[model samples]
Target: MQKLLKLILTSRVYEAAAETPLEEAAGLSRTLDNRVLLKREDLQPIFSFKLRGAYNKIAHLTEEERARGVIAASAGNHAQGVAFSARKLGIRSVIVMPLTTPQIKVGAVEGYGAEVILHGDNYSEAADHCQQMVETTGMTFIHPFDDDLVIAGQGTVADELLRQSAGQMDAVFVPVGGGGLAAGVAGYLKALCPEIRVVGVEPADSDAMARSLAAGRRIRLDSVGIFADGVAVREVGHLTFDLCRRYLDEIIRVDTDELCSAIRSIYQDTRSIVEPAGALGVAGLKKYVRERKVSGRTLVAVNSGANMNFERLRYVAERTLIGEKQEALFAVTIPENPGSLRRFCSDVLGDRNITEFNYRLAGRERAHIFVGISIRNTGERHAFGQLLGEHGFDNIDLTDNELAKTHVRYMVGGRSPEAGHEVLYRFWFPERSGALVRFLGSMGENWNISLFHYRSQGGDYGRVLIGLEIPPKEEDGFREFLDRLGYRFVEESGNPVYRLFL
Candidate 1:
């Protein structure tokens, strides 16, 4: 490893990156009360530091080996790195990726003229399949992080940082997925400047390297939460792990929520959006700076990549406010009497909108309603729970229930669509002062609904499924109004079973 590292130090790859900038980040430095520098690998042509390793590896290949082409497996920046680097070197490259890899990344690899084979559902499975292909095709495998040359090439980032910083960095935070980037940077920095701290950051949901270091041996996770999919590897590579053991000072884990907030922060401060994996180093630095209170230290954080999917932004946006947004679900038992329901809605839930309501006469005197309500904060969750307790209502808080997320929202009752020629498809209007009375008013004076269901899709409107019986002559205008309002409806009025049941 030392000999390979020495060779890499003298290679053309190192020479190529000797002049990369390591300018100070005045904005972040002030925020942390420390002198801060950003290793802007996100500015690489492939938008990742992986290009350093990829280009170095391909450039070192002999003519005969280059003629045989190279193969690699990666679902994120590594794939783009290898593709772009191989194309730059005028060598053929084949990249194997998970079938579920985002279309954006797959297209990027193909755009670089690499033959992309989509296989497996995740990185490990894709990597396994690629290894099999390498053995069969006699093509040289350009590993994403495990090889000595790749690690050495990655180490060049540290060399550039030291040179640009005039050797003043007190600490550096590197993001760890399979540990290649962290190992490479840490290895080179520690080998040259033993006093400089090299810390590694990993997503809490997929901290295989951290867990492995704790266990004092390599351990593979059976499954990893892939919220930060680029770094959602189940295990660190063996070679990379060995390097990490030698050089890394400490491995810190940051939660998914922290990563999301960090993404938002980077966008706010720099107007640049980065994927969750790319934000790990920043997130870790924040936690470390606060916890350690290293106010005077000079810190560097590697901003890794920006391959964020636009669609995933919605989820990140939602989770960013989960603690602040009080979305609650409850199963409440109410009296079977009609007026009892009215009093509970008016007296107990004053101005609190019932997002969902469902009742069933389960061959008993009382009724049970699985209800959902929205609040402004988590504090309201306990407040609402106490309100039910005071009213003597049997209630269960199910805000975080998986089963409720899937099924409870659509449990409203209404009649069959086929029998009611005059079916009035009504949106569950949550704005009424006495929502229960409004619901009963819409149902009929004495008319009972045979079917009703409501559930939120985490959108502006909650979807409600309802079937109501009405006179045949009055249905057409109601149907038109429903269409005009853009509400989705399924008609069951014509079905024989609905007719018979009604």
Candidate 2:
């Protein structure tokens, strides 16, 4: 531990990295009733703290290793880090990335004078291909976050935080992926400032580090959510897991909605849109403060990276209001007589802003309406529901229903009686060309695709909601097929929203 701390203190990352500011987050502090600080690693040369570790590792490579060149596999930020570091060092670098990686990231790596190779569908497959190339060419392979040197370089973040904050921080929140940053920062902080708490933050669906720590060993996940692509690692590094297990005080998991809210919060303060993974520290900090019910203590959140895909902003913006409890969705049944809509609007909705309103006359006597309204908090949703009942309207709160949020809201049409033995499933797959074709082809000739909806979010994975029709006797066979499909899927056939509309 002492040696690791010494290495972090003496790291030569300043040659290619900046001493990013530890600025006060006035907006967050005011809202949370605490002193909130942001470690601006997002302002680094590569727009990510990854440069610190990438440069440190490459700088220490021997002449022989440099002459042979270096290779790495990454879908986003780490690719930029290695490309920038190799350009600065005047050495040949090759970055192998998933075919599904955004063109913006691939172009950025190439702009830094690194050879970019597009291979496979995801990072794991691309990494396998890169390993084969390394064996054949005898080039050095840079592991993203597992190596001691890389971990040491990342630890420098803690050194700067303590110095910049003057060792007065009550807690420091670090984003966890393969566990490099959390391990490095926590190891250094715990050694020097034992009084300061070190907390690791991870996406709820991608909490490999947290789960590993709980199990007392490394545990590999079958799949992970791709919304926070930067930190969507399936397994934590062996060394990093050990370090984090010993140093980190706690690990917190936040969902996609929480991540969206955090991104909005950061944008409000800095006027800079942060990627989902980049805002994870802020999300975890908010969750911690609320859960612990603590106040008046100084807390720091590391703004890890800013390599955001521009197209993802649309999805983030849509979810942010709901995440902050400022939006509510409900299904209301109203009389189909003339002036009924006007009466409901004047008496129930009043002057409240309506974010969405979808309606269809399904019957002669009544109509179903899917409405989204702006509210101050969760309390208002309950109050609004009670108000609707008093106004002689039947209503159901769909605010927390996943099916309603994802599919049924956009699809307000009632179910079709002709569609028999239909099954609904949501599948997550790699977002590469021909991937959908492969999935459809795997279904065989026994079933028909009755409904399908897909929208790209410019991330590594694509989400698809599908409905299939099959005979009742084929139900067991369909289940077996899904299990052998090799994609992450959830059966949504029993979802209430689907039964109500679709």
Candidate 3:
């Protein structure tokens, strides 16, 4: 512990990294009724804190090691870090990125004079290929995390935080991915001031560290959600996990909606946009304060990065209101008679601002309507549902239904009773060109596609909701085909939103 602390204090990072300003989030503080400060790590030269560790690690390499060059594997920000740092040090760098990685990211690394190798489909696969190249080429592999020098370099963040805040903040929130930033911040903060709390935040779908800490061992996930692609590691690093376990007070997991909401809030506060993973600290901080109902305390969250893809803003904007409890969604059953829509507005809705309303007449007896309404607070959804029940309307609250939001809302008018033996699936396909063509081409000639909804978040993956009609006997064959295709998918035939909308 003492050795790590000493290394953190003496580690060289400022040679390439700048000391970012600690700014107060007055808008958020006003809303949450607490003092909120954001450590603006997003202001780094690479628009991420990753360069601090990447530069420091390369700087400390032996002269012979430098001559051999450096090789690293990353999907995005980390690759930029190593490439930028390596070029500054006049060392040749090889960055192995997923084949599905956007050309924009590839160009960024290449812009820094690094050789960008596009391989595999994702980070894990790229990392594996990177190891093979490292062995074949004998280049020094710079691990993104899990290295002593890298960890110490990241720990420099804590040193700056303490000095800037005068070591008086109540708790610090750090986003955890491979646990590099969290481990560094927690280790250094806890070592210097045992009383200061360090909390790590992770996406709920990608909480490998939380799962590992709970089991007292590292646990690799079968797969991870890619909305927040920056921190979507399937497993935490060994050294980082150990440091996090030793020093972090707790780890908080937040869903995608909450994360989007935090991004909106941070933008309001700082007029700066951060990526989904970048806002994890703010999201977790909001959750902590809401759950604990703490007030008048000095809470700080790290604005880790702002390397956001432009297209995801639409998704983030749409979900932000839902996350903030400003909007509620529902599916309601009502009489199919004339003037029923007017009656729903006058009798049930009664001046409630409707954000969205989708209606289709398919049945003579009843009509199922999907609706979104503005709400004053979270508790209003319960009252709205109760009012619908009391008014002789059968309604299901779809506020928390992911399928409803992601697919059903846009597909409310479709239903195919004639399409028998249909099964629904949600697939995460690589976003590269011809990936969809390959999926379609791979389908069996006998099988039929009945329903499809495709959404691309402009990241590593494109989400597709598809319904297929396959004979019962062909189920085994269909499963085999899906396995052979290698895309991550989940059977969604039983999802309630499918019945209600499609």
Candidate 4:
């Protein structure tokens, strides 16, 4: 590992100007009573640490191999790294990525002069296709962070960290995706500085590396939560796993909420928004310090990447507040009747924002509205429930319910045959600041006799499945106008599924 580190440090990619500042985070360090330093790889040229590996790998290639060209599979940062490095080396490169890769990232990859091939539905599928292309085309397959050369290049980050810190470090927190970054750093650090602790952080939803380490073997996950797309990997690389098993002190898991909070915190302190995977190290550091009651430890958190989607900022912002106990999700059940909605809003939820609401008369002896409320805090969650209980309504917390949060929000309402003449419809309203109440106020119940469903998708739009019973004697003009409301509505009043299911 030491020899590998030396080779990497002296390599072309690793020869870039070092001695980047590792500054103490005044706000966070004060909060934890431990000195916290941020290693700002987010500020790197490609907005990631991937450049180190990409350039190192390419720089070491034989002239003939370089002439043959190179290919890689990545959705964002790695693509940029390889493209930029190839451009710098005057070599041809192609990047294969999932079709769903963000438009901005795709553009960024192209901006680096690499031919971008959009294929597959996910990263693994793209990777497989890239491997097949390598076999057929004879192009050098640049395995991102997986190969010995790539890992050594990534290890150069630790070298820079140590060099800049003047060798004074207690612990270093690194993010784990395929384990390349962790393996590299841990391998070199364990070999050189046996006393320093090296911890790997991973998202709980995609913890292949951590799970593999625990099981003493590599295991692939069937599915992964792609919220942290950069780190939502199913399997650890073979070389990376071997190095990590031998050197890593521990691998800690953090949830999406905590990662989001860390993103917000970094933005607050450094004015930089990092992707979910990038924030894992800081989130893990927070967890580890509190859980172990560590004090006065000199810690360095690697801010891995900052290639965040602009649209996802809302989600990260909202979830971060929730993770910090500044927000809560509550199900407020109210009596189903005129003025009940207004009464609940004016009374219990007067100060709180209604992030979501779904009304249904599902087998209710007395009508009850199933409302999702986002409160100021957890105390307000309990208070709202107490208020509902006092009003003879059951307040169940469905905040954590997957179905309730996503699909249920939009799969609402259909008119029953008993309602002689009323059209029904559903829509996904935005889940922030008066959006719901404003939508309701805009659409008064002029003709209401049907079903409604709206679940949160952790997104702006909800997938609403609504059914409405149209008036038997409706005119063509009115029908055409109703159709112009721009919603995907299913007239299931006459359908057998509605008759049977509803």
lDDT tens digits, residue span 1-502, model 1: 5775695576556433333456576777887899877777777777777888887888889999899899999988888888888887888999998765667778999999999998765566788999999999878899888877788788888878777877788889999988888888888888788899999999876899999998989889866655677787877888889889988999989876667767765676667787888888888887798778889889888888888778677667644533224457777777777687888888778888776666655534666666667787667887998999898887777665433433334543423335433342335333213444645644455343545655333222233545555555665755554555432344544533222222
lDDT of each: 0.72, 0.90, 0.91, 0.74
Which tens-of-lDDT digit does each residue in 417-476 have in candidate 3? 788999999899999988889999998476899988997777889889999998899999
TM-score (all chains, Cα) for each model = 0.67, 0.95, 0.98, 0.76
Instruction: List, in order, the clash count of every candidate structure.
Output: 18, 0, 0, 16
Q: Indicate the worst ten consecutive residues by lDDT in candidate 1.
A: 424-433
Best by TM-score: 3
Identify the runs in model 3 with alpha carbons over 4 angstroms from their true place.
none
lDDT tens digits, residue span 46-113, model 4: 88888888888888999999999999999877899899999988999999987667678889999989
* TM-score (C-alpha) between model 1 and the true structure: 0.67
lDDT of 2 by residue, 396-437 (tens): 899887778777777788767678889899988888788888
TM-score head-to-head 1 vs 4, winner: 4
Sort by lDDT, best first. 3, 2, 4, 1
- Candidates in order: C-alpha RMSD to true structure: 13.1, 1.9, 1.0, 9.4
